[model samples]
Each structure stands twice: as C-alpha cells, then as structure tokens.
Target: MRYSNYIGIFAGLLMIVAAVFPWISITSIDAVVTGFGSEKVTRFGMPVLMNLFMIGLTTIFFLVPKLWAKRANPFAAAINFSWALRNLLLLSTCRNGECPKTTIWLYVYFAASLILLVMSVLPDMKVIEKGKE
Candidate 1:
C-alpha cells in the first residue's frame, strides 16, 4: 500500500506489458500505421519494433528487484523516454519522406510513448531514496 509498493507494481506491470505487447501491439501498429496510402509504415516499422524492444527491456530491468525495498535500483529504473520518442517520431515522420503532418494518431502514439517513459522512471524513485545507503 506504500508508494514504493505502488511503484513496484506499476513497474512490474509495465515490464510485463512491454515484454508481451510488442508481438500483440505490432498487429495494431501495423494495421493503423498505414494511414491513407502511406508507405512509411513499411519503411519504418522495424525501427518502431526496436524501440518497443528497448522499452520492454527497460521495464523488465526495473521489475527485477523486490517490491518491499523502499528505493529503486538506480541503474534499473533510469530509462530515457527521449530515445524511444526519437524512434517513434521518426517512424511517424517519413511517410514517403513527406512527413505526415496530417496524422493525429502519430501524436497520440507519441503521447502514449511519453507516458510509458514516465512509468519507466517510476521504479527509480525507490533507488533515488534508498540505493545510496
């Protein structure tokens, strides 16, 4: 019931989702990525996959430690969402090099990516407070 407990639970769930969803989420991504005669998804879907893999790794690493600990594992909990963002942004950008400014879902995905990134960092709060000791 503690904040740390919640963070641990959150990180654990994120890890599981990241690990499992790539294979599942890819279907949805592949389906919707093809927005209006866009060849971009075909060109950049691999890059997006790579980002998903990294996000999955980040969550799994965060979840490795036990939940009772008051602090996060410093290295495990520190994930850079910006890295994934660049990948997602680039994947969203090059619809045949035209940069699909018309796409709203790309922005939605971007926002969701940011949220995942933030969640990725939640486990770190434990380490920041507890790991030093």
Candidate 2:
C-alpha cells in the first residue's frame, strides 16, 4: 500500500516517456508521412503540455505529500486519460474513408495514460493495527 504512490508516479513517468515518441503515423500507397503526437502536433498541443505538467505535479506531490496533492492527483489522471482517449479516437477514426494505420507508439501512449488513470483511481489501503481485532 505504501508503494501505491509510487505506482502513480511510475504511470505518470510512463506517459511522459510515451509522449516523446510518435503517436500516430499517416501512410499512403506510395510513401509514409509525418506522425502526429505530442511532439509532432503544434496546434491544440495543450494535452502534451498538460501531460508533462501533471507528471511534474505528481512528482512534487510525492515529495511534499500534502493533502492538496493527494486530492489533485485524481484530477490530473482524469485529464491525461481524456487526452489519451481523444488521441486514440482521432487517430483511429476516418474522416474521408481513409484512416491511416496507427503506429505502436500510439498504443503505448494510450496504455501508459490508461495505467496512470487506473493507479490514480485506486484507493489507498488502510493499514491494520496489530492485535486490533
């Protein structure tokens, strides 16, 4: 249970790393083109920044261990989860009947963010006192 915090930290870190890699690649019959992810996309890049910011906040929470930090962790996770879900949806859906094949990094990003979400939602375990029963 003590390590639950670490689990959230690990999830956040995973997302941070995944963000650096490509999330989605566009390919055609002739050649492959640029990808769109945290790194590649410029417009509407708040998700990328938010992901990093949340992870940084998570780290700070680990160090400070404040009540506020504990309360805020779930919100951070929710944001990242929605961001990742959006990424998945946008990448997978086809607008003009031509959906590009996604790359492995996209899945990685989703999985990492999903893990972070789950970790944040998990309630802290209560420690049982010895001979209490």
Candidate 3:
C-alpha cells in the first residue's frame, strides 16, 4: 500500500464504475443503440474486457510485488489508454454525416484511463550509487 499505488487503484475503480454507465449513444431512425445491450454488446465488448484486465492487473500490483506484476502494470495501462482513445475517437467521429451522442461517462472513462497510464509509469524505482544524491 504505497502512495504510488493509490492512483492506479483509484483509476481502476473509476473504470469499473464507468463500465456500468452508457458509453456511446446513436439514434438511427426510430432505434437507439447504446454501449450496453444484447444488440450492441459487440461495440462495447472490448472496452469492458480491457477494463476488467486493468482491474486485475492493478489488484495484482498491490497484492504481489513481483517483477512480472510490475511489468504487467504498464502493459495494462497502455491497453487501457488505447482503449479510451479508441472509444473517444469512435464515438466523437461522424459516420454517414451523423455523429453519435456521447455521455459524460465516456469522458470520465477516458480521464480514468489517462490517469491509469500516468500512474503506471510513475512507479519506476531509481537506484542511487553510493554517496550519490
């Protein structure tokens, strides 16, 4: 339970919470497509998967202080960052002259992902030589 681990933990929690919220909303004719639904599950599947993976890795980062865990944290953070970017780009872009309406959750998710990325890289340990400041 170090100070460095707090950011990752908070980011992981935010991601988990964001998963339950709406991601993308598109209205086509009389039909609406949301991030979560049996019809649009494919659209949101990857984000959920990545979020869960991040949560697992962050948990392992706290529980097991192993080299593998340290290495995995960055990889997970990268994936999460990419996932957030992909979602932000996809939902914000216009397709067929119409852009999907994004919810606040999407932005929150992206922010959390970015935080996770920064936190992941902030934990690197530096070794000092003898008598070095």
Candidate 4:
C-alpha cells in the first residue's frame, strides 16, 4: 500500500495513453474504433471520456492526504472499472455475424482501470483511534 498512490497515478496515465490507440476494427464496415472517437459509429457517445474523468478524479484523490479523499477514491475507481468492462464487452462482441478484431490496447485499457481500482482500494492511510489519540 505504500506505493499505491504512485501506482494508481501511473495506471491513470496509462489509461489515458491507451485511449488514443485503436481498440477494435470492424471488418464489415472497414472502420477502426478508438476510445475517444468512433468515426463510423456515433451512437456510443464518447464512453471513454467518462472513464478518463473518473480516473483523473481518482488520481487526485490518491495524491490528497485527507481521510475523506482516501475514502472516496474507491468509489471513483470502481466506476471507472465498471465503465472499462462495459466498453470491453460492447466493443468486442460480434454483431450480424461479424466479430470485430480486438486489439491489445483495448485489453491494456481494461487492465489499467482494474489496477487503478485495486490501488484505490488499498490506499495507504493513517487512521487515528478516537480513544488512543
């Protein structure tokens, strides 16, 4: 837990970088999809932006040395992880007998989100006992 904050920060950065890479390529439409933009698909409505915002908040919470910030970090991280999962499931699935080709960057994004969640859950903190101190 001593390095959780640093690790979480790194993971957040990694997620941001991963978002710029191609996540999947739809063979049927001959289009490539990335986290920030889906040129041929507009219905997704920039799902990764929410994840980026949550990760940014989580990273800030990790840097803060307040009890309340530590407590709230996990919540943001969990939301980020859930959003990553949703993206993975939706993007990799086959539709109309055509399965999109998944890329390594997609998995990397999910892994970074998961790592951020774990780091947030195990944040290093000092809690004083009401009676002891």
Candidate 5:
C-alpha cells in the first residue's frame, strides 16, 4: 500500500490548481463553468463558493494524510464524492453550453476528480472477491 494514496493526491493537486490558478486575473468571468446535461433550472449558474469549497476539501485531502488513511474517517470519501458530484453536475457546461476557454480546463480537472472519487468509494472488488475468484 506504499504508493496507495495517489488518488487523493491527484484529486488534490488538480483542485489546488483549479482553486488558485490564473490568480483569477486571467480567468474569464462569464464562463459557462459546468453543469450536467439537463434542461432543468437547477442545472444553471453555480455560485463560486461551491466551487471554492470543493477546492478546499480536495486540497485538504491532498495535504492531510489522515484523510486518506486506510481506516480513516469515511467523511473524506463523502466529501470527495460531494465534490465530484458537484463537478459532474458541471461537466456538460463545457461541451454543450457557451463556456469560455478556461471552462474546458476546469471541466477536465473536475472530471478527473470525479473519477478519483468514484474509485475511492466503491468497495475494492479485488479485495472483496479474491476468495470467490
């Protein structure tokens, strides 16, 4: 399990770049951000705080070792899942909506985070199925 914490590391670094990159100076204000593929009103306009909050959580996971410990608190997974879900909700804004240049990068980062989160939470099938196999 020596290099076992890579998922959190990857998720964390991506989020850190997302949180502070471009220093907000070069970033676009009118960017579509991201959103799931849905016509519902809930799919529109996410506040900056939500995105920042995720960046913070993910950064914590990356910087804090306790969060990724084998027997650690489950809250980390939940938090990461929340972040991923939030990101997933925003994915379509990149492809389907009128997003700015930065939106694509943000979407990809979050999408990668979503995958990492999924990998973290799902029961490790190999460990669970070994005896059966």
Candidate 6:
C-alpha cells in the first residue's frame, strides 16, 4: 500500500498501451476491433479516448499530495474500470449466433483497469493523531 500511487500510475500507463492493440476478431465480418477502432455495426463509439482521459485524470490525482485527491482518485478509477468492462463485454459478445474471438490485449486492458481501481482504493497516506502534536 505504501507504493499504491506508483503502482496505480503504472496500471494507468498499461491501460493506455493496451488500448492500441486488437481486442477482438469478428469472423463474420472479417474484421478486428480495438478500443480506438471498431466496426460501425457495433456502434460502441470511441472508448479509447474516453479511457485515456479518465486514466490521465486518475494519474494526476495519484500524484497530488492531498486527502481530497486520494478521495477522488477511487471514483475516477472506478469509472475507468467500468468503462473497460463495458468495452470487454460489448466487443466479445455473440451477435446473431456469431461470437467474436477475444484477444490477449483485451484481457490485459481489463486487468490493468482492475489493478488501478484497487490501488486507488488503497492510497498511501499518513494519518496524524490529533493528540500527538
């Protein structure tokens, strides 16, 4: 927990890198989907940009040495994690009896988001005793 902020920053960076790789392959359409690019039929929009914004915010919060920053970090991380899950489910789901093959980077993205959430929840901070001073 002492190094939670550093770990969280790493996770955020990993997520950013993972977003560029292929997430799934749809045999029916002979297309590959990534966070930044997806088939029009899926109508998932641009998840990569949104995720980047969220992760960037989370990383900034992690670097801020304040109680409020620590408190807000978890919220940002949770939203990023939820978005990652949404991307995973939407990209890999079967449609009209055709199931897309999930790629390794998809799972890696999800794992990094999950790790970011955990690290945010356990931010390292020093608590001062009221009477000690």
lDDT of 3: 0.69
Name the best candidate (by lDDT).
4
Worst 10 residues of 1 by lDDT: 19-28
| Cα error of candidate 6 at position 41, Å | 5.7
Query: Which RMSD does model 4 reach against the true structure?
Result: 1.6
lDDT of 4 at 128: 77
lDDT of each: 0.43, 0.65, 0.69, 0.91, 0.46, 0.89
Comparing candidate 2 with candidate 6, which one achieves the higher TM-score? 6
Candidate 4 off by > 4 Å: 127-133
- Give the Cα error of residue 77 in candidate 4, in Å: 0.4
Residue-by-residue lDDT tens digits, candidate 3, 1-133: 2466787788878877876787666676433333333254354444466567666776677456566777778887887688778767866677788777777887888898888887876675545699877
Stretches of candidate 2 off by over 4 Å are 29-47, 123-133
Residue 18, model 5: Cα distance from true site in angstroms: 2.9
C-alpha lDDT of residue 127 in model 3: 50
Stronger candidate by TM-score (3 vs 4): 4
- Tell me the TM-score of model 5: 0.42
lDDT of 2 by residue, 54-101 (tens): 677666665455566667777877887887788678666765667766
**Model 5 over residues 1-133: C-alpha lDDT tens digits?**
3332466556655654554432111123432333322123333444334545654554455445452443332355556557656554544344434432444455555665665565454322224455684
lDDT (C-alpha) at residue 4 in model 3: 63
- Candidate 5 lDDT at 71 equals 36
Q: 2-93 in candidate 6: lDDT tens per residue? A: 99999999999999899888888888778877888876445666777778999999999999999999999999999999989988887888
Q: Could you estimate the TM-score for every candidate?
A: 0.44, 0.71, 0.75, 0.93, 0.42, 0.93
Q: Which stretches of candidate 6 lie over 4 Å from their true place?
A: 39-42
Model 3 spans > 4 angstroms off? 29-46, 124-133
Q: Which digits, one per residue and each the tens of the lDDT, describe model 1 over residues 15-112? A: 33442322211333443332122342454444344445554555555556666432333333333345445645554454433443324444444455
Clashes of 1: 4
Candidate 4 lDDT by residue in tens digits, 12-37: 99999999999999878788889997
